[model samples]
Each structure stands twice: as structure tokens, then as C-alpha cells.
Target: MEKWAFITGASGGIGSAISLMLAQKGYHLYLHYRKGHEEIEKIKVRCEQYGIHVVLIQADLTDLDELQNIGRTISRMPDVLVNNAGLTHYGLFTETRIEDVEQLYQINIRAPFLLAQMFTPSMVRRQFGRIINISSIWGMTGASCEVLYSMTKGALLSFTKALAKELAPSQVTVNAVVPGAIEGKLLQRQFSSEELGLITDEIPMGRLGKPEEVASLVWYLIQEDAAYITGQVISPNGGWYT
Candidate 1:
């Protein structure tokens, strides 16, 4: 039987890259996207070309009830769960509204936590599972004007570490992937042409990291060979942070 991977926010950026990589590896995919049905359809078609079963689901992860429903809908408990759905809010902390902060917490931290809580029991029963959370360098070294976003990701990093310990005895590994300034829509939106160029020059690699690069590490970490590794915040940040 083919192993299954359930990835939230699988429509674009890093999530899409991870899906394609896993498809190439013959993993059936349960792709969860909040919106962008058209883009997800494109992803579905591409995965089908690889002869992988792809199930696309649309649900806002901010809602706990929806997340539970998502857990119930999958045919089998996932062999791998990639909690990649997250949002970024930039601005001075004082200007950020209470509602925005709550939104960030709900989507980035609460949603992943609830989803893991709901699905991990079945994984424990199976005695084999991989939980991969797509965190960020901001979570590790805080970013100015990105305080709320950093807080949520920091919480996820903590969650990954704590959950890894709890699930270690069950042969389940939980880890976080911290990517720094990847070349994505998110990064593009955050930097102007000159600013982005300067940022790239600052990295030891002299360029922004690619989404595929991040996905490749995720692919490796979920493999049987990585069973002994857990509670690790693996950073693929192009030497952005030591």
C-alpha cells in the first residue's frame, strides 16, 4: 500500500513543492487548501500525471470544527502530516489589532495543534508517523515588524519539540523546517527590488533559497532513515542564521 501524506496549505509555495516531491516518491496525497480551487486543480492534475492519488480539500484551518471534520474525511490516518498552513502579518506591534493577533494565533498555532491532537492518536496506534511543520527563521531569530507572525511560528517550533518527545516512544517523529527568505510570493511582497537584492547579498549563499530546497529536506526527514531523528528544528536557511 502507498504511504499517505496530509499537507495543509498544499496549493502553493512550499506546500506545493512538498506535494510534488512526495508524489514523485509515490505517496498518495490529501491536500488541504483554504482557497484557490483553480490553483489546486492545477496541482491535482500535475500529481495525477505522476499516478498518485490526490484528494483536495478546502477548509479554513482557523476553525477547530472544520479541522476535526478534515481528520474524519481522510481514508486513513496519514503516515505524514505537514502543517504548512500559515499567514504573515507585518507592521508595528502597537498598530496590530487584537483581532489580527487572534487570527494569527488561530491559523498558525491553534489550528496545527488541534489537527495534531486529533490525528496523532491514530498515528500512535499505527506506531509510525511523521509530523512536519513548516516554520520560519523569524520564529528562531525574531523579525522587526513581524512580531505577531514570529510569535505564532515560535509557538509551532515549541509544539514540534514537545510533541516529538511525547511521540518518540510510538516511533513517531515530529520536526520543524525553518526556511529563511525563500523566493516566494511572501518574500517578494515583503521586499522591494533594491531591498531584496541587498538581502540576497547578505546571505552567505548570495541568493534566496528555493522552495524545492526546503521540500527536499522535508522529504528526507520523513523517510524511514530519519526515524531516529526527532524534536529537531532543521533550518534550510541559506546560511541566514547559524
Candidate 2:
């Protein structure tokens, strides 16, 4: 049987890149998106060229019940689960709204935990699974005006490490990819070219990491060669956090 991967935030950016990469590697995909049906359809069309089965599931990760329902609806448990759906809130902590904080936590922390819980049993039974949580550089090193987002990601990092140990004996690997500033709609909206250049210059590599770069690392971590590696937070941040 073809291995299957479940990728949240599969509509664009890093998530979309990872989906395409995995499809080329011959993995069937279950893509989860919040509100980008048009974009998802485009990805589905592209994925068909690779001759991989593409399934689209639209559910806001903030709603844990909906996520569980989606999980149950899928025909088979995924061989790999990429928890890439997350929301970011920027502003002084004092100015951030409680509702926004809650929403961020819901998507970043709660949803991943619940989805993992729902799907992991089947993986354990099969003795084969890969869980990759797409975290952030801020999650490792806290960022100003991004306190809540950092907290949730930090929690995810901790979850990755702890769960990796728990599932290792079952041949399941859990890890996180901590990415630096990538060229994407989200980063462009937050920083001007000048500001982005300054940020990039601060990195040892003097360049923003690309989404495809991160996806490549994820691709490696899910392979059979990576079986011995688990419970690790691997940062591909262009030497930004060293």
C-alpha cells in the first residue's frame, strides 16, 4: 500500500510545498485547509500529475471536535501527520486580545494534541508512523510582540520531544521543524523589503530560508533512514538562532 500523509495548512506556503514534495515521493495525501478551497483545488490538480491520491479535508483546526470528526471520516490512518496549521498574533502583549490568544492556542497547541491522540493509536498498532510539527524560530527564541504565538509553539516543541520518546519503541518518530523567516505572504505582510533585508542580514547565512528548504528537511525525517532519529527539534533557520 502507498504510504499516506496528513498535512494541515495544506493550501499554501510550506504546507503546500511539502504536499507536492511528498506526492513526488509517491505518498497519498490527506490535505487539511481552513478556508482556501480554490487554492486546495489547484493543488489537487497539480498533485494528480504526480499520480498520487489527494484528499482534501476542510476544517478549522481551532475546532478540536471537527478535527476528530475528520480523522474518523478518513478511510485509513495516515502513515505521517504534519501539524502545520497555526495562527500568529502580533502586537504588544498588553494590547493583544484574550480571544486572539485563545484562538492561537486552539490552533497551534490544542488541535495538534487532539489530532495526534486521535490518530496515534492506529499508528502504534501498525508500528509505523511519522509526526512532524512545523514550529517556528520564535518558538525556540521568544520574539517581541509574539509572546502568545511563541508560547504555543514552545509547548509544541516540548510535546514533540516527549511524544517521540513515548512512541519510539513502536517505531514512530515525532519531531519538529523550526523555520526562520521564509518568503511568504505572512512574512511579506509583516515586514517591508528593507525590514526583511535587515532581518536576513542578522542571520549568519544572510538570507531568509525558503519553504521548500524546510519541506526537504521534513522529507528526510520521514524516511526509513531517519528511524533512529526521534524526540528532536531540528532547526533549519539559516543559522539565525545559533
Local distance difference test values of all predictions, in order: 0.91, 0.91
Q: Which ten residues in a row have the lowest lDDT in candidate 2?
A: 59-68
lDDT of 1 by residue, 122-238 (tens): 889989999999998999999999999999999999999999999999999999999998988877787898999999888999999999999999999999899999999989978
**lDDT tens digits by residue: candidate 2, 42-70:** 99888879999999999977776787799
RMSD of 2: 0.9
Candidate 2 ranges with C-alpha deviation above 4 Å: none
